[model samples]
Target: MAESTYTVTGMTCGHCVASVTEEVTKIDGVTGVDVDLPTGAVKVTSAAPVAEADVRAAVEEAGYALAG
Candidate 1:
């Protein structure tokens, strides 16, 4: 499996984490999603390397922003 770490902004609660997780998990090849609310850290595990743009879009769709 491949793993990638990203910083997500605007997540404030469990619902935010759930939203982010749900959107990210919908991506192709994504095996799992772990979100750290305190740190805004999102770790994505996938069968292959996922594109940053795809992840960004997913985060946006969840009403969050991907930190640069």
Candidate 2:
């Protein structure tokens, strides 16, 4: 499994976490998603290395921003 951690901005509550998780989980090959609201950290597990742009787009679709 390939795992990646990304910092997402604008996540203030559980709902934000859910939204981000829901969106990121939709990406092809993604097997799991874990969001830590307090630290704005999102950990994604996949069968392969997922593209950073794909993660950024998913986060944006969930109304968040992926921090560099």
Candidate 3:
């Protein structure tokens, strides 16, 4: 398995986390998601390394920005 951490912006509440999680969970191979709204930290665990482009797109789909 593989894990990656990303900083997502504009996450301020439970709904924010849920939205991000929903989008990211759609990615193939993703096994888990952990989001810390206060710090905008999102840790993603997957069966394989996930592509950066896919992560970014997922974040966008959730109405947020993935920090560079």
The top-ranked prediction according to lDDT is 1
Error of 2 at 15 (Å): 0.5
Please give, for residues 1-68, the per-residue lDDT of candidate 2 as tens digits: 99999999999989999999999999999999999889998999999999999999999999999887
lDDT, model 1: 0.98
Clashes of each: 0, 0, 0
Summarize candidate 1's per-residue lDDT along 1-68 as a digit string, tens digits: 89999999999999999999999999999999999999999999999999999999999999999998
Among these predictions, the greatest TM-score belongs to: 1
How does each model score on lDDT?
0.98, 0.96, 0.96
Q: In model 3, which runs have C-alpha deviations exceeding 4 angstroms?
A: none
Per TM-score, what order, best first? 1, 2, 3
Error of 3 at 65 (Å): 0.3
Any runs in candidate 1 off by more than 4 Å, and if so which? none
- Whole-model lDDT, candidate 2? 0.96
TM value for model 3: 0.97
Backbone clash pairs for candidate 2 read none
User: Positional deviation of 31 in candidate 2, in angstroms?
Assistant: 0.2
Measured with C-alpha atoms, the lDDT of residue 28 in candidate 1 is 98
